[model samples]
Target: MAAIWIAQETVDAAQGGDRQALESVLAGAQDQVHALARRILVDVEDAREATQEILILVLTKLSTFRGESAFSTWVYQIAVRYLVNAKKLRARDPGLTFEMFAADLENGLVADPPKAPDQDLLLNELRTSCTMAMLLCLTLDLRLAYVLGDIFELDHSEAATILEVTPAAFRKRLSRARSAVHAFTAQNCGLVNQSAPCSCPRRLPAAMASGRITLNDYPNSGEGADSFQAVKRRIGSVVDALKSYELFSAVPDHRCPDDIRHQLTEILSPNI
Candidate 1:
């Protein structure tokens, strides 16, 4: 009976019509799918939709999953296809432009913080900065390579697999992406408010303003709360400084905020 049960599972998967098996496969790769989709869609609701489409494509195409590359690669390829199509579909509006993208990025960079702290303003800024269409249009290989490479700290080789390219090719793509981002920043520097930066009193986190959290009291407080708070204040100070920095003047690389700091550091590190 045990032998028969094992055979049944294998046969069901081979048939490729087993929805449960397909769902199981997708469930196992859920994080990977969401990450890729988020890189493409950016917006949470739209990313969710794109992810569903990618999963459906994977299920429909599972029969073609001959033991070629790993199943994850196959799924990523499918995801790339769906994401490209979705982008093309959205592009038909005819109103999209670099200006629109810059506006989106600048505005998104400081929008509403998540209702919760673990998913708060900083994380929102990080996501918006990474997903801004200005950055996405930087290449044809999808936006995964750039985001994963710098923002998420994924290695070049790992990024290459997600991008479906060799590490060397991935490096070239990253270079081009960085160049495009620089051009975008140069072109939009005039628009960033230099007079009042986003460090508005309202947006400043409590820890940054008062410095009273030194003695975080809780039954099971994490070991480094004080250190983390210090970093938060430092980041807050940077944001506050942007309000007064002349956007039109040459932006010193050292002054760039965390969102695009890596790119700025690469270009300005030598000058500094």
Candidate 2:
């Protein structure tokens, strides 16, 4: 039924200004539109906006589609264009904070990776790990590509079409995006800079929370070595937390799944 509605006959009639046919196409494509919006925008409100815009554009530009690709692909193509533009616009807005994004991230939820929808414990654990800030830094194009490729596990060629890029180009972008995401995760997880000043233990967060000493004090060379030790202890606490959580374990090796990591990133992201 869905395939029939989005087929060329329906699209042709809809483009001919047939309102009922247009509605049929929309009804049929609604799920696809929402899924694409959510994956690309990672925010419910943004997803809805993107979906609305995509539908409208599809309706308005139906005649321009020259049958170069599958109807679904064309629809996704339009959605991807809108999403890319939206991300750029949002990034420019100084008032839009990570908190807003995190809150909105829950919109247009899709099936989890590994098809574990019944695993509520895993989902809850992953939700807690969702970090919004890190997610935001993962450029708009990267997010689209990552979702289509990694989470949805689409092949390179298909993902490239969704991104409107050549397969090789898509692969390159995916590689870079994956690397950047890893670095972002490592920085937030405090694993890459094991010895760096910021790479301290998690216990120090308690000190930070208490405000016993200013963070600036640790950087001052003239400040007594005691202040430095306090910094070290704090750094240690962070490291210990990472170790305890086994955040650095190889993929599929740690108790915490990627879903959980994604969740943590979302939660801590707003604070950043």
User: TM-score of each candidate?
Assistant: 0.50, 0.52
Cα shift from native, residue 230, model 2 (Å): 40
- Once fitted onto the true fold, the runs of candidate 1 whose alpha carbons sit more than 4 angstroms away are 1-20, 87-137, 140-142, 151-158, 161-166, 179-272
TM-score of 1: 0.50
Error of 2 at 120 (Å): 6.6
lDDT of 2 at 238: 62
Clashing pairs in 1: 197-243
Candidate 2 residue lDDT tens string, 74-108: 88778778776766546643343333543433233
State the lDDT of candidate 1 residue by residue for 206-250, as single tens digits. 322343122322111231123323333433454322311222111
Q: How well does candidate 1 score on lDDT at residue 83?
A: 69
Error of 2 at 148 (Å): 2.1
